[model samples]
Target: MSLIQACVTAATTLLAVLIGGWLTVRTQDRLWRRDQERQWRDIRLNAYTDFIGAVREYVAFILNPAARITVVPRPRDPGDLMPFFDDVGSRYRERLESTKTALRLVAGRPEVVSVSAELVRQARLLAAARADSGVEALQADRFDALWEAERRFIETARADLGLPSAFVS
Candidate 1:
């Protein structure tokens, strides 16, 4: 072939290769994004379930701290706190799995890590609050601090996910 024709053929092949590469990348990228969104939703759901359940447990425990600690020393009884434990435990496990999946999908987004850490912190605080119950905890700052932390977490979650305050768990 002539020199000009050879150059034209080479350019065409190069263009075709580039276009094919771009198409493949686009398709993969789209699929990845879709999957990332799915994972985000799943993690959020799990986080909500466990986190909200924990919050409800705290509220109930607070309503009658005397009954929970004094009247019924076995606060973990099914009628009082056992069920909450089960719910929180199951939900937390689910949340953990979903979080790992999301991290894999998003490749370690810092916000997610921070949120997860806060979730742990909140759980620990609640557990601590439960430990100091009845009259001993009536004016304890631990419970208040825990409540404040939870409120902050809810607000942060809302701001990040654009969910309403009611969506907080």
Candidate 2:
């Protein structure tokens, strides 16, 4: 081959190597990003589920007839429940707080944080309602509002995590 032809062949080979390397890197970067997104979505799902579960447990304790009685060791007698109140309240409160902290660590969007705060607020309202009236009052008046807040939180978290919503037609 001519010297000029040999140089041209080498230049073409170098160019092909560079282009192939760039494409490979670009494809790998895209795959990495997709994997990261999926991992993040899973974390958000776990956190959100935990937070809701804690909230439900709290509400259940409030609505439980036994919660109204005051006594230590949690009276087995259905009539004596006052002592169980403080323990149940604090235990569920800790669970809710722990879940919220986990969510704060994993949440990528500000709206999810905001909605989580709303969920906490609504759950507190249910607790307060139970205190003011009775379990019957919570079922009557406060349950709907708490349900709505929880629904909003779930929807917002799903959107933030890029999960598809059944509500979207």
Candidate 3:
């Protein structure tokens, strides 16, 4: 080939290589970002599930009459019940706090974090009320409020993770 043709061929090849490299890098970057997003969603979902589970367990323990008796046998004096409440409440609170912290760290939206916080707050309130009085102290209003908080948290978390709502219109 002539000198000009050789230089033209070299330039064309160089251009093709540059374009190919750029495209490859762009595609790889996109894939990496997609993978990272999927991983984050998984983490957030796990955190949300864990937090919800902790709250449910805590509520169940507090509400179940058998659970209370199993934790600490009833004493002749009603005042002696404080120790039982303290023990069960503290253990459940620790689990809830740990899961809440994890949810906050991985939550994609502020709403999810706020709702989770509200749920935790409601759980704490219910625990306190039950501890101070007795299981009978768990009023319907407080129970409803706790359920509402949980519903909001679940909704927010579902939205954050791109999942459909549990309820239908």
Candidate 4:
């Protein structure tokens, strides 16, 4: 073949190879994105469940200071439950922080962020109820208010977490 004909053949081969490489890379990227989405769903499920556990613990803490709380090797009940109370409080705090980290890694969807924040608010309100101590009826009313807030905040969390309403009870 002539020199010009040889160069034209080589150019055609290069174009075909480039197109094939592009197609392979595109297919690989699509599969990888699907796998990452599945992993995200799993992380969300774990984080949501942890949030539920922490909220319920706080509600119990607020409803009755004298109620028993248990840990390995011992169970504790006291008017002040100070040491045990502090431990439980810390546990909830840590769970909340980890959930936040997971959300950030997932790009922090607004639904998840709002619901999680509401649950945290409920926990804090219940903690405040435990601190309310006085003979007055108005002081007693704080417990009632705290209980209402518990239901309100947790409902939002449940919906965002994709949990059924039946699970709320």
Candidate 5:
């Protein structure tokens, strides 16, 4: 081929290589972002589930009549009951707190964090009741408060994850 034709071919090849590289990089970057998002969603889901589970477990324990009776020697007696209450409360709180790390890592929305904090607060109240007055003192109002807090947390988490408001479970 002539020198001019050779120069034209080289220029065309160089342009094609540049365009191909750019497209490849763009596609790879998009895929990488998508993967990161999916991973974060999974982490958030696990954290929410764990936190809810911990709260529910604590509530159930306190609400059970047997647990209340066993924990409290008598309604008026305040001797030696606190140690048992403390042990149960600390164990469940630690489980819940462990999941908070994962939650803070992936929770981007403020509502999700706030609702989760409500769950923690409600759990603490239940723990305090168990500590001070025993399970007999865990009234319906307390359970209702915790239940409402849990529902709000679930709704906020679903919204943050792009799920429909009507989404159940």
Candidate 6:
């Protein structure tokens, strides 16, 4: 049309393109942030699961005599369990430690890491008790303490991951 109208149309088109580009960049940036957060949560969840699994396996091996038989040859004498305990206990402890390290690396909350330490401590206690006095010395309170520690760790990890507590009972 006229020179003024042409300039006005061109300016309006330029403004619209600039605004559209800015909105597109903003939306993409938001989406990228959300995707990164989801990936982080998944990584944390995997780490938490691995740590808990290691704890459970270690505890089960220590507390359940039958489980030990499946892992290693059963000792003829109860007193002969020392060697077995040393071997298996160290392996389990290593697994626990590695998993704990992974959890600590990914954990965003301090409580989860603290609770995991408590769980590891309880597992060690149970292993020590079993080693010193055999299964007979294994007390209900010791088992309860270990279980409670594990539960606390699970709850703390779940909260950190924004998941609802599954062990409310």
Give the TM-score of each candidate. Answer: 0.46, 0.83, 0.84, 0.54, 0.77, 0.83
| Tens-digit per-residue lDDT, 40-157, candidate 6 | 9999999999998998888777866643322232355333222234555667768888999999999989998899988887776677667655676689998999889988988898
TM-score of 2: 0.83
Model 5 CA RMSD to the hidden true structure, in angstroms: 6.2
Compute the lDDT for candidate 5. 0.72
Candidate 3 lDDT over 1-169, as tens digits, reads 8999999999999999999999999999999999999999999989999999999988887776644422333345332222234565568767877998998888999999899878876776676567656787668998999999998998889999998998775
TM-score comparison, 3 vs 4, better candidate = 3
For model 4, where is the 10-residue window of minimal lDDT? 74-83
What are the lDDT scores of the predictions, listed in order?
A: 0.55, 0.77, 0.80, 0.56, 0.72, 0.80
Instruction: Pick the winner on lDDT between candidates 1 and 6.
Output: 6
lDDT of 4 by residue, 116-138 (tens): 66555545544543444422322
Flag regions of model 6 displaced more than 4 Å: 64-85
RMSD of each: 8.4, 7.3, 6.6, 8.6, 6.2, 7.0
Which residue runs does candidate 5 get wrong by more than 4 Å?
66-84, 130-138, 167-169
Clashing residue pairs found in predicted model 3? none
Q: What is candidate 2's local distance difference test score? A: 0.77
Number of colliding residue pairs in each model: 1, 7, 0, 0, 0, 0
By summed lDDT, the worst window of 10 consecutive residues in model 6 runs over: 66-75
**lDDT accuracy of residue 66 in candidate 2:** 68
Q: Candidate 5: which pairs clash?
A: none
Once fitted onto the true fold, the runs of candidate 3 whose alpha carbons sit more than 4 angstroms away are 66-85
